[model samples]
Target chain A: MTTAAEFQIEYLQYLQADGKAKSDLPSFASDETLMVNLYKTMVQVRAYDTKAIALQRTGKMGTYASTLGQEALSAATGAAMQKDDVFAPYYRDYAAQIQRSVSMLEIYQYWGGDERGNCYQNNPHDFPMSVPIGSQCLHAAGAAFAFKYRKQNRVAVTTIGEGGTSEGDFYEALNVAGAWKLPVVFVVNNNQWAISVPRGSQTACETIAQKAIAAGFEGIQIDGNDIIACRKIIGDAIDKARRGDGPTLVEAITYRLCDHTTADDASRYREDNEVTNAQELEPIKRTRAYLTDVGFWNDEKEAALQVECKKNVDAVVEQYLNIEQQPLENLFDYHYAELPANLVEQRQEVIEGSL
Target chain B: MNELTLVDAVNQAIAHELASDPDVVVFGEDVGKNGGVFRATANLQDRFGENRVFDTPLAESMIAGLSIGMSTQGLKPVAEFQFLGFIYPAFNQIVNHAARMRNRTRGRLHCPIVFRAPFGGGIHAPEHHSESTEALFAHIPGLRVVIPSSPVRAYGLLLAAIRNPDPVIFLEPKRIYRLVKQDVPDNGEALPLDACFVLREGSDVTLVSWGAMMHETLQAANQLSEQGIQADVIDVATIKPLDIDTILNSVEKTGRCVIVHEAARSFGVGAEIAAQIGEKALFSLHAPVQRVTGFDITMPYFKLEKHYMPSVEKIIAAVNHTMEF
Candidate 1:
């Protein structure tokens, strides 16, 4: 474990940089299915990222944000969270939603710009994907306050990019989280670029993790490529926040292996060397090596796992695409709690036209 | 008439609503010990105790965000923004988050957050304090906006806003908050948030307006009576839903229309009125709908203010222009 005087960088990490498994690591002993499930979910998210970029090229989805290199941060965070805990995802948190049993169709429909895809009609504790920069951070903080008010023991987890720190909502949320000692964890996945604007241009601060200092809360910077390390840090922050010790700002230091979204061309702004260097820090590859070395899996099992995951993804994709189209009239109907006069007329006009 | 100022009536409404519903809470900057900048929340913190009503920091976005979160958790949050202009920082929470929460969650979660902001130009205040941004909120989907003209409407409409399942932008007419006095029921029942109120009836022309402009619209109708021009005045309390039936029926009777507002003329609430008339009641009009609105300029200091505000004279002049057309 890397320890500093101000912050304790805890590592439940099973592997070192050389891909060797550690002898001692905390076990998720309560359930092995959950561990298998997390790995499967992460693989599914990676598949979705790859498929979504291809779809965007073919013009199916609009400006999609791919969580390619950052799956470990999202999956590990969601895996460490309590079952009943609420999760508010930013535009790129597909892995968190996937780990929560949110179908791939729902996530796809959402990034596709259908508000219905955002609706969690069945999920009891999931929020829609928020895209207005740092606005969702305040919602997470407020949810944490509500949980504390109702005496619920659930931690609220949400994410933002490093550039999101410049928004007023981010500071306001952190201040409220500090002042009220709410059970919320703000994870700043410092993927370097917030849509082409690099980290240094966004803020002169040495690190985004250091911003939490003004709010009287502590923060930790972690190597996000370490999946187990990300899991342990997120889990500790969640537990601490829920105990009413207040919120923690986690800066998962990582890089975006892909473009910001399919609409972007990183070649214009980013150098080939930068991306090539990030390839050496593949989070999935690191985790897989440890699993193999620790006798958790073999070459055959790994191949089999990939085949099963691809088959599952293909089946779901087919099912979702086969679904029929819905009418546009429902758009105006959901605009207000009850039908407005103008919308009522607008809906009638559309229906008449369709007829 | 049992008279009460608009500010007093709003305070009474909040107090009565808090008394009636245990789920209702109130908070904002200078809202507790200071009793709010306009004293609308005066005696509230003391009467309801600090938990139910209290002071929040100067963070407007966080305040609005907390309201949306609290409302989704089944609490009725009546939050205050010191001024209408200050709410821009919180527009993400108000417009994107609170307004869309219900539609985003399907039927699972509904945010019943009421944003009570003092608005408009008659008050010779700071540059930012005198703004009529009602049209902006009205343009957004999934939000209900209300602007009351007098004490009674302020009391009743606010209570209606408090009970709405979707978020409501309750813009109080700051200029008329301390100016107007009228009887309001203290029994705590609010009117529907989707309907408009017909303040005056005539058959020559229909005047559609809301908020502080309601009084000016009525005054214009009164002025037109001397020249034998009968003008029907309708106050669109809930601007988003825009009680189109009342407006269409009124315009259909008059065969002429004049939309009045204190917001800038271009792309303001008046534009919607003119557009709706053109779209829905085009054949009913003897002439095209005309609008008497504030000049297309930023709300300047107290000196150049009169030119920026609409009055009875301006409304009558617009009526004359529509009649000539």
Candidate 2:
């Protein structure tokens, strides 16, 4: 008998839970600006998440999905990509969207029931934050297909939760990306829970990254809580994609330290002990501890960073609150390039009827 | 000018668009080396090369999402579903994403993709192959559903759909894909969308139909003309954002109206036409609008497809009933 297929799923963990690296650090870890920038971005995203939850509690915004513990995943993935590369991100990727130049104010506007929130000015290639689970994965593949067809040296990166990986769109996208050899990367934030359902119930596969193996691509797992591992692994995958080496599936193992959304009460399904343990392994605290251990950050810098992040978030919130309600005609206007005659009458009807 | 069937005209139009625009791409199942299932994209991959015209994985949802993504990035992707019934898997991408992309993005990004599917019965295809679900697409706020009843219209309307800035669901009548032949010039002239073409002039009753059903409708009109009951015939090419002005004008001239369609009667496109006629042209002093349509049931297999479809007799009877009133 001959062994036909042999496969292995690689796992990466650079920084352990206590903020200690098990081995020698990559060269990029020594770059002071990059290290501090990652830490600061995680802090900013955390502050933004707290403020968004507050706004939702006060009835100022819609129910928001929080990236409370998965900050390193977004920071690393967003920072790794080139400017021209497109990002088809899911709703929980607020940190990544901000990195792509989708302003925090715009994200605020979106959660506050405004369409203009998705209108990106700086990074025009990035798609609006997709709310319908795993649908953006296919969009990423299509964008990659366009790049490959046009011979453009660019890659498309999409982020999704472990729950999104279960959706049929995820597999279909990966299948196409693999078969076509498109320049795309799928970053699965394997946060242990998909609403009330835990990761155990999501799939029978040992690791979500292994799901990519059946699709004919390299699949790898990484310590999503460790910024160094995230940055290095995702940056390497992106470079490979940009070099036309085909797609990669990256399952960043992390935990959701918050409720699924502001609307969810995770305590009903998840035990307090589990949440407590996961909190100890949270991305922001681990990165902060790593910075402290290296003497690159101190108590004074940590306090000042917190205050700065709060100030920045508050400024964006103020800007978001000042925006007036969009006109009613805006609803019908953007539906088509040129409003047809029937819609013209319909728009007038809406105006007259409102009065 | 070459005389071609509706399917051949569809191929010609795709070839023209791919030749004229560097950004236009055509992809679907078996659309490349095997051509399309219906051959609507025959010889396209060979003509435009594999990059411009290609085959996609058998996943319809991915095909739709891919088109939406490509369209946002300045490519005009004309994706074909092997058949209309297969499009249900992709309905989410069509209705939720592609249709709403422009509105959700506040016009900053728009999908200019054309989703083509061969629809309607009478082709003797296997189960789940024949369907006429245009009304579902027409009801979507941002989607434009256009169906062509003839070769000339197929060539022109397909070109127009490829050129339109918004997403269009171009439901080609597969039953008529090879049924009729007409002169379709290779000049790349696109006909206007959201307009109706008055096929015949009459004074008594107006007959409205679209897609493959137009054959029975026009036949009935000609037969009705022989009986001294002159019937005005209109082919509603664009089902959504309909040319109500033309339909109303024809209705006003001919006080009686009969809407013909092959889709189910309940909440079908015929119902919309009837409701609009009652709303605007009600006082024209004629009979209540009559609808000659298919029954509300799953489109049955080939054996009973004829019984499910509207026939010339059914349309003529409706016209006669309206004229007598």
Candidate 3:
């Protein structure tokens, strides 16, 4: 036998599940202000997610995907990205969208069934929430191709669930990104369960990160619950991509603590004890624990943060509810640059209540 | 002015846009150095650099998804699928994303892309290479499906499709790609979309068809003219936002109609035209609308393709049937 090539997946972590450090922390941990901001953002995301689910339960919104145990992944990715860089996010990356200036009111309006919610007033370049699995990966790569073609130092970042790796579109995106040496970063949120299907059943591979190696690139695994590690590892990948060193795949290992969405009942297929055990290792708890142990956070500070997040979430809900329904013509207007003659007649009929 | 075939006109139009618009990009399997399988994009990568015209990995979904992304970023991406039969993999991206991008975002972003592919059956080729599934795209609300039958129309409509501020499904008829030649001017003039071309005017019957089927339809029109039954031949260049007004006017004048297509008869673009004529022009139509189309089955392989595809004889028979009725 002759040796050809060998590769190893590198694992990264800073904070353990029990308010302890696994090793020396990354350089960013020394910045107390940044760490506090990261914690605050994660808290806000959890609050927003909770309110969204409540609204869905109360018949105020449509089916909502809650990012209950994955706030650290969203917050860290958002923090690492620059304003000019585009973020192609999947449905559960609300924290990252908020960081990019997509308001909570807009998110509410989206789940409430309004197209105007996608027309971001501030963040014009970022893509809307991609509900289709693994499709956004190619869009990110295409955006990266445009950036590289224009000779701009910008990176395109995208997130997908671990189960999405099975999609052909996902592999196609990775292969093209590798072949073209495009500046894109793929972050796989290995949240253990894709709806009712667990990770073990989703793929036979030992790790999702190693899938990138097949595309001729480096793939790394990270402890997604650790806020410090999430930010550091994803930030490093983004920086490398921006420098035109080609694409990287980061597989963040986390767990989905809630049902897949407001429509799902996880208890039907999941054990209560397993859920209880996973909750102990959830993202927000460990980050909060780490902050408390380091003296950066206390009971008083935590209580204040919770209140602030609630007030913010409530205000956005009010705004979302107060917005008026878009005119029926809006449905026909944006389908083309200018409505074609056929659509014009259709729109008129709609307005006249004859359609 | 230069004599050009339909495929030649396609190449000319793409090359003209690549030269004029810096944001225009061309990519697909075998499109770069090979100039496409049909040579529809011949010499483009050489004329423009690799960045402007390039080849992509053989993934239809990626080609479509990439075009959506590039188009959102202000790049006019003209992507090609090797064949219309091979475009099923990208159907989700096209229908869900490319078609809905502008509407979903409320005009915050839109995909100004041209998805081109060689379509329809005639020349002997393998299975999955000859498909005239234009109706599948024409049925999509946000897409503009345009097919060209002649060199002049091909050159002009392609320019229009590339410049349209929305996504267009540009299906080239491989059957008639080199069957005819015409003097096509190199001027970057774009014909108007959402309109039909009146190839010949008559007062006996209106004949409607597009793509390669237009060849047989035109031949049928000529044969009908020789028989002293003046027929109005209408080329429905853009089938999606159909120019029903022109068809209605022609049918009202002629008082009879016969629609032709190479796709399956059931629920085809031909069916849509017949339904519209029934709804709005029923009073004007002297006889029932007749359709000459392929049977509702898989497009047979080369040995049986001629029997499956609509023929000039079949179109003439349809016209005679409409006239006799």
Candidate 4:
């Protein structure tokens, strides 16, 4: 018998769930200021998610997906990316979006059912939050193609739920990325549950990261709850991609602590004990513990950070609440670069009918 | 000026754009060394190099999604699906992303892409290769669905679709890809997108069609002329943002109309044209508008393909019925 091929998936972790170092820290962890900033951003995203859920509960916003337990993954992914590189993010990637210069107010407006929210003041090349499962992967591949074709030193980053790995678009994206050796990173937030479907039922594969192996690329698993591991692994993948080393899939294994969205009730499908167990291993508490133990954070500073995040979230919510409804013409204005003659007449008809 | 077939004209337009615009890229399943299955992109990869003209993995959804991503990044990507029927896999990407990008982003980003697919029946090909499903895309708001009949229109409208600052579904009528040739000037002139072309002028009745059906519709008009029935032949170049004004004007002048298409009869482009004519030109219309279209069934394999398509005799019969009425 002859063995034609062999593959192995590597698992990475820097900090254990108890806030103790499991291995030597990556170089980025030595940067106290950068670590603090990432920690602060994750805290800020949690604060924003809390307010967003409250808005939905109060009927002020649409159904909001809570990024409760996955903040480390989102924040680390965002921090690893450069400003010029494009990001195609899924719905629960508010932390990444904010780090890319998309404002909290804009995200609020987006969930509030307004199109103007997608018109980011900065980060114009980043794709708007794609709601469809697994579709953004291919978009990232396309962006990578453009970067390679133009000889630009940029990489495209995209994130999807572990469940999205089952989609054909996901595999198609990986295949194309590998075939073209595109500059892109695929980060799968293995948050255990996709809505009500658990990771075990989503696929028979042992790890979501291994799916990239079939596409002729490397795939690795990381402790998604450990911000140090998340940032280091994702950052290395992005750097490798920028240097034209092809694509990599990083499976950040974590747990979804909250219901899929405000509209869903996790209790209906998941056991209370499961949620209880997952809460103990959530990303924020361990990161806070590590930060505090390392002397980069203290009770006074934590209180101040919480206060600051609350103040920022409150200000953005106020601005979002006060924003006037977009004009009716806005509906017709952006449908094309120049409105055609028929559309011109149709717009007039709609305007007159409104009158 | 060079005599070019419709497919040749398509190649010329894409080649011209690739040469003119640094951002214009061409790619599909076999678009690279193979020059596409129909050779519509023949010699494109050779002329433009691999970076500009390349082939992608056989995934339609990826093709559409990639085009959207590239277009947002200041590149005008001309992505092709091998066949219209095969484009169903990419429907989600096309309808949800490409068609909605500009509107959803409020103009911050827009997809400037041309999703080209050879569409319509009459080619003696197997199933899935011959189906005119332009209505599916025409129903999308931000997508411009354009089809060209003759070589000249193929060259001009394809150029327009590629240059238009929005997503366009450029459906080439494969049935007549090499059926006829005409002198097409490679002058980079683009025909108007939201307009129709008046092919032949007459007064008795209006004959409305586009794509492969335009071949049979024109033949029917000529046969009608032999029967002392003058017909106004109008090619609806752009199906979406349809140039109903031209059809209306012709219908008003003739007071009778017949629309022809090879796509399924129900909820098709023909139905939209007929409805529009009824809406704006009801008083001018002397008789009920007639439609000669394929049955609402799967576009059958080659053996039964002709029976399923709208033949010249069926179009003539409908026009004669309208004329008699």
Candidate 5:
């Protein structure tokens, strides 16, 4: 049931459950080497997720959250934007960060409790991973406000879950963005759960995107698991804002196919039927199948892509796991322009106490 | 020098900062054309232009957030909260964002912004207008809370806050804004936020306080001096990152201290000063750190505001008692 929009449903089936891009996407990638690089990045990011889960099982990371199920959504949405466009992601969007040159090792380091993991050689084209619910939206809006004030065409995109819209900052940021007509694309990744609370408990509204109208912006909902649909949704919104139409609220209706995080056990609160059904609509698998029907399927190419993806991940894992852990003194750093006396005292005590 | 009241000095500071630094912009509810609720920002728009001084929407968070946005982009912002009580709506942005922006950015971003608000009891104002919540902000690491007691200090400290490279919380004691006047230095003076100004030195005891309470401390000092008990009046211009050297040095010399503040007695600015003295100057002191502070009640409306505040009587009582120990 494709509408007049550019989104295609069957094209969602070309990718495998394992995250390989289907054959049809090759054309989109071939002409734009950027897309192929984006594809490889998605695969590696997924692998990184898998490794993080494994690491968390043994106490390497503290309460790790996953983008395992939303890899395609992040990749497709990120792929639609260029480097100059700003992305403000939640703690769960390392997939988007990787494409922006936020190193895998840094992600590992941050999940490992190091702010240095957050440090980037470049701007990473993203604001910091916002930990507080919906706070990043304000930062995104502020960046867009800055861009608008300077009359820049660069779009600032921020992501939040359904639960985030309930935060006061969410309403505040939305009001500011809409009032100022800032060039921002707000993607509410309706992942259906905030921690143990389900989306239904967050709001009575059928969709978060519709809330945008109340805040003075047009709202749209799309199947987040459908790559073509996601790309079309994000691309159109970006274009509209670039032409100075102000902001748009995009609700990418996606499911958290995996448990919310490594620490989560969906079996406790979520029914098995729901997970199984969502698994069937995994964005990567749908894209691969769509490519196969479009003459992009071949066993050799699939094997090669897997090897190439795994090789990159393994190399990164080696680099990440082996990077010297952040020194304890680093905890006291990065908090003030001038290191206050108390912090210096605390740092010294920590060093001495550790000794 | 201008024969200005404390409120006039604040208005003067806003006008002077706006004139001196093109980057220094001032805005809050009714700050434009209306000139702020207390007229602290009166006539700034006419002098500095709307771009340099103007009114913000009724939203406190937006006012603070917009300031953060503006400051990060190179504008020096002096954001006002129409009243101390109304400032809580923007507390999150102030505490979580503005306070931490510099440290979070690894010093790459310096939030040279000042939050100006009239605080403490005395006026029979609304519940939120007569609050002494500077202690909450002073406790936060990256923030420097400066409380001005008189016209002279207000002009100097307000200017220094603007030039200071960090986010400075300039808490204007609403009660004292028009209560007093003084000979303000011609060009004003810059006082370090981490230092205390010893207003009057004595050997029997030191009276330590800031903001509105400093007036009461001075009054108490005058009262103590009348009885031949030498009293040192120490004005803690800056509350956070307390001026430990000055505090300890005074206590060591006088061997006694009476901390004063208009906030509720429990965990107010006085508590920090007392605790620090207890920890660092305990052996040097002749008695436990005595604290004269406001009653632990929501400030009453204007009729009882004076009684609700810590007074010369209370400070005199605390100082007299400390002599027993």
Candidate 6:
């Protein structure tokens, strides 16, 4: 006789790609104002992304990772997170950062290579944007461990790309979170492309969510293009974590509709036909169709929303450009809480030489 | 006051910190119930409970990354790696995250974590167990690299590292973990983390060393005293922000300097010390600086380990060369 452990992975898609409702939505979906606000944030993030790319082309900004077709993951994540919880984000989390009160100018400043851009006046516990792939998952696990140790009802949520699932940090984090029963949730943004490498070539596993099973946790897949599904799934995972129900892995299936960064040329590696197909299933148009079907939004409202987003992006860009550069000592100052004798001398030498 | 070995002193310091501060936590592979491979964290689990002291999966990256995570949220994490050689897996986390967390966040987030690892070779351990790569960590800007030479310094420096508000890599010299004993007072007093301790003072030649090499350095100093060549021995407790002033002062009086370390000779902490002395005290030096260090080759097996280690005779030879010059 053979004994085998059977496992089932759940996939959620409440809103179809064509903006049609596939099933009855969650209670929060009935809140038209909340849905409209989420839609507006996505629009704002897209506008910022366009402006950033334009600035890079004009030699004004540095290389930037575009959120392009994957804004729903960040939108739902940022909206569902509470003030008390900590968020450890990856590089492409502009919408999430904006929702958490990190100003657009600050994000631009960070991309411009200014360390002071990470100094968020609000959400002091929030970690800086992790540029190193899946490392933020480990940080999320550690923060969750702190919450569990203190007996606090807070959860840590981290985001990673599909390619990041193959990293050792991702696997180890999920393992520790399961073994220690920490309150954490990992949201994998399966945008189908990690630079030139496609999602299929990144891992041999059936789905990225199934990788969590090896670490003994629940893994769920959701339609990342559907805002209602994204919010519901992330909110549920966060609630489960807050209830001390170990950790959960939510894989948001989406597509990267643009180059990885301003420095990368996707046209050299990817086909235009595939990009065109993905654009049809992008998040913004689907969400707009859903809102129109619900009678909550229309073409007139969208036009006005686009104009407002442009104005907002333009103002933030001006502020970012006009901001004064910090003194040179700022580089050596934050290295430690107090400068030691050697560093003090080095700082003095640098200042004197500059003078 | 209690007479404790270096390992016992490390345990005492960790337990003391865990008791005095509720936010302090300790964890590593086999560190909880097993009390660590070398028993440096012995009896800490029972005393501090499982919540404060625990075991983690056999993953160095997670150990380092978790410490970074726990530290930013008002907790002081003292994470132990099984051995210094195993720290390579967590190199990215250490250099990219732990060392840069403070500066990257511009002081908004800081990691108050202490990564403790048993380093150096002498006990005939297997490969990947013995390494003195202190220079690699010290090279990173945002980290404080500290090593303890004796029981008292171990206890005091560990307490200081645990209480420090920044990330610190506390390297415990495994070769001297129980090599000697000293009376350490449990008064919760911590030694400074950025200063050096002068073990012996003299005016003939300055012998600079840290970690386990201090043992042979002191022995060399004693032997040199018998030969009428009094040597000033300096234990560079904090290797990163080196106490060069103390070394320079000793060199100014002695007019000669001899550095010793067990790590590979190229780009070691000794090289940094020699460079600083050459730049600052070129006029005071009566003779060129000499270094007695391990070879650039990988550490050999148990039988040949003695030859690879910097022996007392080699230190004496370096001292003789500097004095004769």
- Worst 10-residue lDDT window, candidate 4 chain B: B119-128
Best by DockQ: 6
Each model's lDDT comes to: 0.82, 0.91, 0.93, 0.92, 0.76, 0.92
What tens-digit string does per-residue lDDT give for candidate 6 at A120-170? 877688898898989999999999999999999999999999999889999
lDDT of 5 by residue, B84-130 (tens): 78888778877777787665544545567888888877767766678
DockQ for every model comes to: 0.57, 0.85, 0.88, 0.86, 0.36, 0.90
Off by over 4 Å in 6: A1-4
Encode model 3's per-residue lDDT on B30-131: one tens digit a residue.
999999999998999988989899999999999999999899999999999999999999998999999999999999999999999998888999999998
Which pairs clash inside model 4?
none
Q: Candidate 1: list runs displaced more than 4 Å.
A: A1-14, A21-24, A27-37, A57-62, B1-3, B223-230, B280-288, B317-325
**Candidates by DockQ, descending order:** 6, 3, 4, 2, 1, 5
**Between prediction 3 and prediction 6, which has the larger DockQ?**
6
> What is the Å distance of residue B304 in model 3 from its true position?
1.0
CAPRI-style docking class of model 1 based on DockQ: medium
Quote the lDDT for A280 in model 6: 90
Give every collision pair in model 1.
none
Q: What proportion of the real contacts between chains A and B does each prediction keep?
A: 0.57, 0.80, 0.84, 0.85, 0.19, 0.90
lDDT of 1 by residue, A1-355 (tens): 8643364433245556555645455566223465556666677789878877776778877778889888888888878887788887788888887777677887777766676676664466677877788888888887887787677888889888888889988999888888888899999888888878889899887777877877878877877777776887888899998788889989888788888888788999988999998888867777766666656657887788888877876776676566566566766666567787667777899989889
The DockQ score of candidate 6 comes to 0.90
Please tell me which model should have the higher TM-score, number 5 or number 6.
6
For model 2, residues B55-161, the per-residue Cα lDDT tens digits are: 88899999999998898888999999998899998988888899999999998889999999998888899998887889999999999999999999999999999
Tens digit of per-residue lDDT, candidate 6, span B1-325: 5999999999999999999999999999999999999998899999989999999999999999999999999899999999999998899998999999999888889999999999999999998888789999989999999999999999999999999999999999999988898999888999999898999999899999999999999999999999999998999999977889999999999999999999999998999999999999999998999999999989888888998999999999988888888
**Comparing candidate 1 with candidate 5, which one achieves the higher DockQ?**
1
* lDDT digits (tens) for residues A236-331 of candidate 4: 999999999999999999998888999999999999999899888888899988888888999999999999999999999889999999988887
Clashing pairs in 2: none
